[model samples]
Target chain A: MIEVKDLRFVYPNGVEALRGVSLKIEDGEFVAIMGQNGAGKTTLVKHFNGLLKPTKGDVYVDGVNTKDVSVATLARKVGYVFQNPDHQLFCESVEQEVAFALKNFGFDQETIEKRVSWALQLLGLTQYRQVSPFMLSGGERKRVALASVLAWDPKVVILDEPTIGQDYAQKEKLRQFIMQLRTQKKTVVIVTHDVEFVAECQPRIILMKNGKIVADGSAKEILTNPEVLLQASVIPPQITQTFHYLKDIGLPTNVIDVYEARETILEFLGETKK
Target chain B: MRFMVARESVEVIKTEKLTFTYAGRNEPSIRDVGLSIEKGEFVILTGPSGCGKTTLCRCFNGLIPHFYQGKLEGEVIVAGLKVNEHPTYELACHVGLVFQNPENQLFALSVEKDVAFGLENLGLPREEIRKRVDWAMKVAGVYELKDRAPYELSGGQQQRVAIASVLAMRPEVIVLDEPTSFLDPLGAKRIFEDIYKLNQKLGITVILVEHRLDLAAKYATRVIVMNDGRVLLDGDPREVLSLEKTRLLGVGIPKATRLYQLLKNDGIPLKSGKVPLTPEEAAEAIKEAFKSD
Candidate 1:
């Protein structure tokens, strides 16, 4: 759905964030952009929605070049959720926050209400419909932010650090929500530092370093490669590390998730007994 | 050998029947929270987000009523000084507070100027400010970045500069409220390592309000778990972490402890005594289990 060709982005101060990077993301694919701070992951993703224009190269969404489209019009095609929820949320009530983008896109009143309600239901935020956005907790505010973007019904959703500052349950909820988005065939691109979350989600992992794509493959391929993960300042998940150690000890198990690792170990023991 | 020292000094901070209610809110943020911390001890205050951990830390630095107007029912004393009675500037000298967002605390153009801002505000002599600025930067391990701008540094480096700025005052107690929340894992590790060095090497009394239990479990001498504006658990890390109740407390444990628990629950003949703090320790335990089997 998205294609980039030799993309290069430099800030006005002459700091190049994306340096001749290129990648192709298929339609309805869930891709995660992983990198450390200052690795230019955020700068690269901002170009997808036209929040940033590449200084030297081109970014195309569904064969439409971003350089020729207005940011607001592009935003309707590619929704972006920032790292801080407070940066995007300015409405008083939860319902109004979700409907803000729909109204801005000039949707009719009835269609806007329907989209807002559907978005709230999808994120499980309907119960907080009338509550003030400022009074909600951090996790709840993040859900509201997601709903705000999702209400616009964009083809692709880009989330920046969606799981930061969240507890285990909340993170799990977000994980499942992202999976659901993938199953619904809406392209999802997440820029994050949480390696464990990315591992659990098992999306197409794109390792970006110094404003360039270093590795692009399945999560198992990218996560198991210690050299790539280390260069990105990302750690392999504990389960992945365990399997790596077990494999070193002559156990041939390619387990990436915890449940699979448990089953593989149990099966290995059974085979030894046989 | 790590020796457990007997409590030698009176409580530097003691809360008696403390209750704090934010303006226009009927429910109190902190409710009858009675706790005490001895001198020269490291304590971790943690809970789910918006569970009054930040409010409790604010009370320590006289930001409760001095900087914020609120309904306070109980007294909070720091180093025998009542927080409510003193000005925030006076309390700031003795109780240095480092907030979660490093960008909010920094205002100077350069790193050195930011580190020396607090000391200069106290009207210390130029020589003393210079000495303290150098010492604090060295202690916080940001001396190399002295000429850099605060905005130019990474989140972790910026936080270290913020800590250095607070440490320049040489406060008796230093309270950091989720200082590593915004940082990446490596940056988070750097900040906590700095805190550990400060507490161990310099003997600074440290109180951290954090959510990352894996980092806090390794260094904090005491862990204070808060829920619903009250202290839920407080004691040594090993004792508090071993409780089954902690798993249900909604805060996560260290990765090592979780791995150990998973192995033990699977009928692995592992010593289920004290929880390991690092992955290296967990690996050792696994090796020991395999050897015995």
Candidate 2:
């Protein structure tokens, strides 16, 4: 659904955030971009939605060049959730916040209301429909941001650090939401350093370093590689590290998620009957 | 040579029935909360978002009433002065409040100017401001970026400059509200380490309001969990983290502790004296649980 050819981006002040980057995201593919701060992860994804046009090469969504598409036009197919919810939140009420996108898209009032309610109920914001968003907590506000984008039901869903401030339970809920998006055959792209969440989601991992795509592989391949993660300035999930550490101690282990780590260890111990 | 000893356990902040409501808001943001912290304690203030954790931190540095128009209904004492009685400028010298958004705090063209902003505002001599600014930048590991514009820097770099600006003031206590929310995991860990070092080297009381418990929990001596604008659980990290209430509140428990709980519930308890906080500790405990026959 997304294609980029030799894309390079530079800010107005002349900081080249992306350099000669090429990526192709197929339809219904879930990809996680991992990198350290200032690693060009955010700058690259902004091109997916025409937020930042390439300074050098071309980015295409469904065969249409991003340079030809306005941000508003791209918003119809690509819904981008920013890292900070405050940057996107301006509405007074939670319900209005979710409906803003639909209203702007010129949907009928009935469709707008139906989609808004579906998004709100899905994200568990139904109870706070009338409450001002400013009164909600940071996590709830983030959910509102997600709901706003999800209500539009764009073909591609891009979330920037969706799990940043979330707790385990909240992260689990988001994980389920991502899975639902996948089952619906939507392309999902997440720019985040949340190793555990990435491991849980099991997305195709695209690792970046110094404005370049250094490694792209499965979560099992990328997250389990301590060297690759270290080069990207990311720490592998503790459980991944824990199991990898035991590789020399004669336990067959390449587990990434905690559940897999637990079951693997338990099975190994059970087989030994120790 | 004469020897002097620092006062042990001196109360740096104390609150009595503190309550605040934002202007035009019917309900109080934070209600009837009472708490205290010592001069050198590292406290983690966390809870579900909008549970008034930020409001409580604002009370520590005189922002609740001074900057934010609000109804203050309780006493808040910080560094031996009543928070309500002091102006924000006066309190800024005693308490450094680092906000969540680095962009909000970093407005100076260059990083050095941003770091120097606080010291210069205190009307310190140019020489002293330069010295303090340099020292603060070094402590925050932002000295190299002194000439870089704040707008050009990355989220993590901007956050470091924000911290350096606050550190330059040499405040007795630093209150950072979700300072690393915009950063990645590695970036967040690095910032937490800097805050931890500041607490250790400078003896500055650190009140970090964060939800990344898996990263920040180990550094905090105390974790204050709030829900519904009230203090729900406050105590040692190990003790407070193990409670079911904290988990039920949707607060992310550290992965190691989650594994420990999982094993313990399955009748395969880790043989540790206390709950493991890191994966290594969890590994050791599991190793013990499955020792060779």
Candidate 3:
């Protein structure tokens, strides 16, 4: 669904964010870009939706060069969610916020209303339809921002730090919602440092460090590699660390999630007793 | 061993029958809260999001009434001073607060200048400002980045500089409200380590309002859980974390703890108690279990 070739981006102030970054993401593939601050994760996502024009190289979305497409048209196929909810949410009501994008995309009022309702229902925000956007909590505001994008029915959804500042319950809810997006065959790209969330989601991991891709592999492969994780300033999920310890005790390091870690340890103990 | 006096010997803050409600909001943000902190205790306040942790922090720093228009009831005393009667600036000298967003708190061009801005406002002598700036930088482990611009540094570095700026004032209490929420995992660990060092080495009273239970579980001596503008649980970290209700409350246990819980349930003959907080400790427990088995 997305392809980049030798993509390089330099801000007007001479800060190089992306340096010859090239990769391909197929349709319906959920990719997670993990990095510390200033790793150009945000800069890389902007190019996919035409919010940023590459200083050098090219970004192709569905075989069409991003430079050749308008941001408005590209937005219909690619959606970007900023880190701060306050920056993206500007509509007075939740219903209007979700409908704003559809109306801008030239959908009629009736169609816009239907799509808005669908997006609200998908995000579990239907009951908040009449509430002021500002009156909602931080997590609710994030849902509104996501609903605004999902309402347009974009094929690719790129979220930057979607779980930041969210509590455990909110994080779980958002993770479930993202999983639902996978069922719809939408390619999902999440840029985050929440290692546990990344582990639970088990998406393909692309680790970025200092404007470069350090490691790209499955969540288990990338997270279990402590040296790479430490160098990238990323912490492995807690369960991964637990399994590493269990491995030191002659146990297998095959567990990825916490629940699996528990079951694996229990089975190991049973085998030892037998 | 030259045993210094215990931190509990010196009381720094006390609250009694404290209640606050934001204007036009029916529910009180903080209700009938009574808490106290010794001179150098490190406390972690945690709960679900929107459970009034921020409001409780603001009350301690006098932002509840002085800066925010709200109904303030009861008394909050900080460093022998009542917050309800004092201006925020006056209260700021004894209580320095590092907010959630580092971008929102920083205003100076260079790191050294930002650290010195607070001391300068207090009208300290030039020599004192220089000495305190150096001390704060060294304490926060940002002395190497003093010449760099705050914007040019990474998020972790910027947050350290924020701590340095607040440290230059030499406040009796330092409250960090989710300082690592905007940082990566490594950055979050560094910030927490710095807070731990400050509390242990400098004898600074530290109040951390955070949602990262794994990190907080390992660091804080006292854990206070808040929900619905009230204190849900208050005790040592081990006591609060071992509750079955913790999981039901939507606050997760550390990954190591969950693993240990599983091992115990499987009749692994491990000690039954609060789970270990660190990976190293968990490894030690596993080794011990293998030896006994």
Q: Which candidate's DockQ is highest?
A: 3
Docking category of candidate 1: acceptable
For all candidates, the clash counts are: 0, 2, 0
Model 1 alpha-carbon miss at residue A108, Å: 3.0
Clashing pairs in 2: A137-B49, A137-B50
Residue runs of model 3 more than 4 Å from their true location after superposition: A117-132, A135-137, B1-8
Question: Which digits, one per residue and each the tens of the lDDT, describe model 2 over residues A33-121?
Answer: 99888889989999999999999999999999999979999999999999889999999899999999899999999999999999999
The sequence of per-residue lDDT tens digits that candidate 2 reaches over residues B153-228 is 8888899999888888889999998888777778888999989999998899999988767778888889999987
lDDT of each: 0.82, 0.87, 0.85
In angstroms, the error of model 1 at A259 is: 3.2
Q: List the DockQ of the predictions in order.
A: 0.43, 0.59, 0.67
lDDT of 3 by residue, B16-116 (tens): 88899888677788888899889888998888877888888898889988887889998899999899888887888899999887888888989999999
C-alpha DockQ for predicted model 1: 0.43
Clash pairs (backbone) in predicted model 1: none
Quote the TM-score that chain A achieves in each candidate: 0.96, 0.97, 0.96
Measured over all alpha carbons after superposition, the RMSD of each candidate to the real structure, in angstroms, is: 3.2, 2.5, 2.6
